[model samples]
Target: MLDVLAGHAARVRAADPLAGGQDRLPKPGLGEQLVEVPGAVGLASMDRSGLDTLNATWGPLVVHRLHARVGGPDPEAALGALLDAWTAAPRREPGPLAVLWPSRDTAAVRALAVRGFAPTVTVAARPRRPPAGQATDPRVRPATADDLDGIARLYEALVAYDAQFGWVTPRPSTPARIREHLTGTLPRSWAWVAEHDGTVTGVVIVDPPPRSRWIASMVTRMPAAYLGVMYADPAVRGRGVGAALAAAAHARLDAWGVATTLLHHAVANPLSGPFWARQGYRPVHTQWVRQGRPSAR
Candidate 1:
């Protein structure tokens, strides 16, 4: 557990050099502490003494720790403290702390802004509903092993679009990779495709979260949620084809009893943000970075 925590700290440091990293926390003897918070699993790797010291010395740490515990009872007070701490800290420096939260958390969103974080990307938490106002003429069906090549082409297009922003670029899409993602028998892990007369026009893929990670984190015993890739031929952009493909993917998840879905979209995408918002999504937590200063753009 300590090793894992150390490794995680190393990753945090690598991603943001200005963050004090593990060195900010009092040394190890602080056995791992895990708590269930409102929107996420709260973990503090240091021990009680370390935590107490942090609360005493750093006003920001005090606010963060208190918020972790009693924020539910007085949300606004906790939020205020968070904002105060954020103001005291310099912007453009990597935060010594990091948190993973559900994208729907309003408090987390506010906290990010307080910490001088910016909305780097947007994640949409879409609920599963029947596809609305669309249909495909040649018809849509589950994508099988045979449709691997077409799926690869669609994934490639999606990844290429992702490259327009940020540093973590996805690999070039390929058939082998598509097959690998769909090999197992698992709920909410499936694919769908639309074909026109003698040609494939659109494709998508859905994958449920893995079981082990949830169990380890004690999130829940329930089956995981789903995410996917989507793409349609440019010629059919406004023709309801993308919506149909999305509806088909949602249908597959619903059949598997997955009602909640999550997906990442570049904040710069013109249509994607409003499209998901119309589908009922709001911002949760964002992945923020500091190039030279602390303000979120």
Candidate 2:
């Protein structure tokens, strides 16, 4: 397994230097499957069940994830074999099957495409850059516990907008959960809100490196930070509120000497793609998913 992973890592490095060697996988649980595709690179299936609240708020209710070590003479065939084995097996549970592949690995994308997968989200990264060109936007200020109501409101707007893109959804508990989370982290995490005429119009939340360990492995850079949440009200779209909030977040991350600032955005979000691009983030890992009929399981 180590040898196979090493070979795959080498190929990924050649394809995109920005994508670091992140091929290791955790031990699979009871329902997971380790596929055997003879002469194929490697395949490990994951069951992202058992955590209902976490999964529903962040992703599909039940997700079947894949770790495909594709990078050989014929990566497509290898990935195809993994998919064939996966499909032939009876599915006891369902949601969407996701495979996170390097954005630059165009060769492996074919296997996923033919199997009904579409790239829905991208984990983007930006290296350390100079601090904000000017003073922090006067309209953007550090969030306080007092701003919970406003921050939560903008968060709901964000979820509602992103839900239409088919990746995120809101549950009955989502609002309370979000409120609870923000209540706990507002004072500790790097959070900011944009105020237009005294009404909060935008919100930005980035997890400090210490709090970003959950996603740090996705990138090779050290001392990484994760931009967990960001939303701008539709009423204030054309204005620079969103940009101001983002600039504030970037300035904070830069001051911390972060090597990489990472965030995930839905591929279907027409606005997010261009917005994050302008913010200097690019796709390092593209999360491709195959769904059943409608959106969720």
Best by lDDT: 2
Candidate 1 structure quality by residue, lDDT tens digits, 1-297: 343334434444444332222322323344444443332223343212222231221112211221122133333344445444433544332322433333433433465566654555654555556644345444567777677667667665665575565422343223344445445432245667788784667876667556323312212223445455677767667776777777776655656665456666766777678766765654533444222222211
Runs of candidate 2 with Cα error greater than 4 angstroms are: 1-3, 41-43, 48-54
lDDT string for model 2 (1-297, tens) is 566576678778888877864565556667566775753443456555333363576676777777777546777787788777776777666677788889987776788899889999999998999775678778899998888999999888888888887877777778888888888887779999988888898999999999988888877887999998999988889788888888898988888899999999999999999999998899999999988656454
lDDT of each: 0.47, 0.80
lDDT, residue 1, model 2:
59
TM-score of each: 0.56, 0.93
- Evaluated at residue 250, the lDDT of candidate 2 is 90
Model 1: lDDT to the true structure: 0.47
Give the lDDT of residue 27 in candidate 2. 66
